[model samples]
Target: MDHEMTPRPDRLALREWHVDDAAAALSVYSHPEVVRWLIPDMDRVPGVAAMRLLLQQWIAESTRITANGGRWAVYRVADGRVVGGAVLLPLPPGDEDWEIGWQLHPGVWGQGHEEDCAFTLASLAFERGHSEVFAVVRPGNTSSAAVRRNGMHWVGETSKYFGIDLQVFRLRKADFDRTAPEGHQPPTYADI
Candidate 1:
């Protein structure tokens, strides 16, 4: 029952955030193309101070989430480079389900990296005892919708903090198990 068995170290890698990753992180966040679908106002050029603050928050959140068993930094196996990040944020006070979200650099888009990362995260979620995982895609984000459709079912719609409409997709453990390709394996800690 060790969750470790679910993530293989030989294929994809999932690691923790590092201060040295600040530049790469900022590059991804500050890219207009990358932030277009995200709800945050990362479209503008954030000042040095703002960037530092954001990195600091990501670092802190990474630590906290690791302790809670719900965060990951995705890296490519071909090269030991961080490609994206994802997390399973716990539900709020009255909510009963965890939310799964991910973001990859624009350079890696259309290469199936996002789908791989999503599948890895989803597998990790199920391994850690989650009954289901949900992804909220902003309306009109076809790429994200496609990623969601790769292994999840179209559930319905919901509203975000700013009242932006979001299309909700979900994947239960059974669904993921049945849909995952044969010979598929999740990433391991050493692979990071």
Candidate 2:
């Protein structure tokens, strides 16, 4: 197994994607509740084979992060189960700005897991020398908007993806340092 597949002690242990996780991932992605906010044209009920293909693609992209940068699967520390995913994708090559995105299973909704994972990912990005992290959310997604508001400043709208209106929010390294929980020190990529 690759070192990235190894769990980190400090984080909720963002792990590498695995083929075995397809069933669980399908459960999350196929659910109407979860898909409501995702890509509208997404398969409402993705099959296990399709999910496995998606997982394979994710694993491949993550492997390229050393050269291209990307996302990670958010696993729970308590059980090592895959709960969700997070990513820091560059808007344009060689640019310091990146879009940070996260999606948690509906099962963990209302329990603050998203916020915890977001904080961990943001800290990871800043420590990796990223100047800023931004999230684009739909206006009606109150829960996601709340998570964005917690540490990010509203940066207005942009019609870049999803073919729908989006509200952009950003968090600079400086603002993240001031707003993150007390004693929340940032973690270098080596720390992961």
Candidate 3:
């Protein structure tokens, strides 16, 4: 899956996560309401420095994700805030299905940022030539589960992801075709 990523600027660009993003990321990831929906390991993030190290690691791993697909800081177009994060990476080392995930600050929740970021990234993934994209969500995290309305379909549950009972949602390239044009652009905050 190694390949170059497509550049996006209209909705929100999927740029590499950075050390500077650590504080903003912490603002989103450290919130009890938001982090609860993420993988349990995130519970170990103690403070800003730990979050900075994590973000540094994210920058270190950026090349791999970019080679396979991409991950990003979820750069907001309107005000240029780092709302949260988004990624379309390989399904672990042995699997073929690519995974898409999004995390947005609760302050920005219900503002459509999650949908726009996820949509833009997924569309970029299709452009990068992946046959399918998947999103794994905690059964209780109804917020992330909203990928269903954006063209992903329920594919049952699995504990394979982070050893948790999670609901899986999938969207094939055909699913994209039936749902959106090949070059479709996702909506931005201004467009909302």
- Weakest 10 consecutive residues, lDDT, candidate 1? 1-10
Pitting candidate 2 against candidate 3, the one with the higher TM-score is 3
How far in Å is the alpha carbon of 25 misplaced in model 2? 1.4
Give per-residue CA lDDT, model 1, range 58-117, as digits (tens): 768756663334555556665666666667776543446777777777777876556666
Query: Model 2, stretches more than 4 Å misplaced?
Result: 1-11, 39-41, 66-68, 92-96, 161-163, 182-185
Kindly report which residue stretches of model 3 are placed more than 4 angstroms away from their true locations once superposed: 1-12, 180-192
Rank order (by lDDT, best first): 3, 2, 1
Using all chains and alpha carbons, the TM-scores for the candidates as numbered come to 0.79, 0.81, 0.82
- Candidate 1 error regions (>4 Å): 1-12, 40-49, 66-69, 91-95, 160-162, 188-192
Candidate 2: tens digits of C-alpha lDDT, residues 1-192: 111212234335565678898887777778877667763346654699998888888888777666335667777676767777677677543544577777778887776566666676677677677777877777787778545645788888876655677787888888786666544454446634
Compared with the true structure, all predictions reach lDDT values of 0.64, 0.67, 0.69
User: Which pairs of residues collide in candidate 1?
Assistant: 8-186, 8-188
